[model samples]
Target: MTKIAVLGAGSWGTALANTMAKNEQDVTIWSHKAEQAKEIALKKTNARYLPGASLDSNLKATDDMALAVQGADIVLLVVPTKAIRQVAKQLGTILEEKRQQVVLAHAAKGLEQKTHLRISQMIEAEIPAEFVTGLAVISGPSHAEDVVKGDLTAISIGSTDDAAARLLQAALANEHFRPYTNSDLVGSELGGALKNIIAIGSGMLIGKGYGANAQAALLTRGLVEIREVGKALGAEGETFLGLAGIGDLIVTGMSPNSRNYRAGVALASGKPLAQVEEEMGMVIEGVNTIKAVVDFEEEFDLDLPITRTLYQVIYEGKTIDQGINDLMTRPLKAED
Candidate 1:
């Protein structure tokens, strides 16, 4: 059996642990809280993040990072993006006794708010390249709640190393949960990160009583903005049109279960972003990713009007009506 260590016991992390254990892999999950570990180990449940779901018997939970990762063939980092650096730092100290040949995969999606670095870059910075072996980011239309319920879903696995990517593809692909492999790490990672911002826009549209036409327009235009940034960053344009890009946008933007979408709806309902997060009890990645997109636009000289307006609405106290009007008034140009 392939030994896999999954860091973080949040919903998505727990869902992945369940998936891997279902595959008969030896899966261990690390949680910072001893109580969380105890819940999973004893009751086989992660009530806080994934209620009503029973974890697989093959899955073990631990608070000790070293014990969770000890002699694992693969390590899956599933923590929130903000917690990634600290987790990687701790892993560095604990994995010193382990061989450097382990495959590293992460499921988190977002760029660092202050540094504008993607999760992959942050991991590369914190973990040695040799031990890193290769990196894979598994993402797409996946909701932790849906996965825990055993609903069918599809995701993309991206890496520069084709062989390593294929290895992950084999590990994660299943009858209900499919995994597609791609080499465009930049496009896949950026697509996953940027879709959260668009999902916020979608929620705002719904909150404001916009019909399906407006929602479709926002989703399409959002893809355009994502593609523009991807192009500026040298990502393959076609990748944006694929599973990790448009597919992810459609699911996240439309689904109420998406944390980003919920965050947007809360914002549209006149609640402060912080208050919304407090009520939701989960990390809304789009809130931070929107700031990162704003920074990227300024740094790269990209004209992402949708992103700009969204940023203003979220950060600069602009009204939703004002933001929509600003987007509507942009000079007409030929459709690309």
Candidate 2:
């Protein structure tokens, strides 16, 4: 994987593209906005996403989808969940026109709203087998801010096919960036998407004047719910303890750099989901993830109290206090 195209010029996409460029890989990052792409080319800094961090001069940027996907050995999808389908569909159109078989990997971390599909699942649904030779998901606790700053960050790449995952692991791994491989796509994807929900809750807790004690309880019980849901979806029990599960949960739920966490603060301040997301200038995956989760719980008959409560607060116009009270006053049960 020397020739790589990173879709989306958001914080994560820019960071990963620079990382690969530093490792001496031929990289091009695609941005939907032409000005952002031009800025990346001329200025060599994505100030909107990564302020003050210099991008690698070797890295390329483009707004043309055909140019970005054409002849690339690997394509890394880094857009938010809402944009995945349109991007994948558009990528598929470009990919089908080419004869080269490409490996597709995604770093996006949320389920599709209406389809409730994982990012890889959505990609596969869009791209035919003739174009996409392999699919893998790169997830875990790698925050874009920390990653670009050269902080030591460990994450996981999961795939049913070992060759695809290993290819990405080797291509992405560096001294400061650790990429662990796993086979549980269900666990990995679910864990990655679901943690944002809890991250929003963590932020709401901070904004509501809740202490570390509450956050700890939330994280622990949240882990249990995550594991339960993963198992219900055919995920391995131990996957929850791995990088994609607990590792992702810890980082997204606690980190200030997380858009989901920041959105939680706004939600706690009695702001609407739309306003919070608009003000943050980024997609808050947790809000959308909660709606998908709420849909899944009803369709699958699963119990997700924290997720449900957050949905109530955000969608049903219920107060945060009332939602928390509902959670605390629930019936007692075993720690299992």
- Backbone clash total for model 1 is 0
Q: In angstroms, give how far residue 246 of model 1 lies from its true place.
A: 0.7
Residue 268 shift from truth in candidate 2, angstroms: 1.3
Q: Write the per-residue lDDT of candidate 1 for residues 170-273, one digit (tens) a residue.
A: 76667878889999998999999999999999999899888899899999999999998888877899998888999999999999989898888888889998
Which pairs of residues clash in candidate 1, taking residues 3 or more apart in a chain or in different chains? none
Q: Specify the poorest-scoring 10-residue window by lDDT in model 1.
A: 92-101
Q: Candidate 1 — what's its lDDT? A: 0.88
- Residue pairs with backbone overlap in model 2: none
Model 2: per-residue Cα lDDT over 54-142, one tens digit each: 88888899999889877798899999988898999999888777766888998999988877888888888888878877788888898
- lDDT scores for all predictions? 0.88, 0.88
Clashes of 2: 0
Per-residue error for 325 in candidate 2, Å, reads 1.8
RMSD of each: 1.2, 1.3
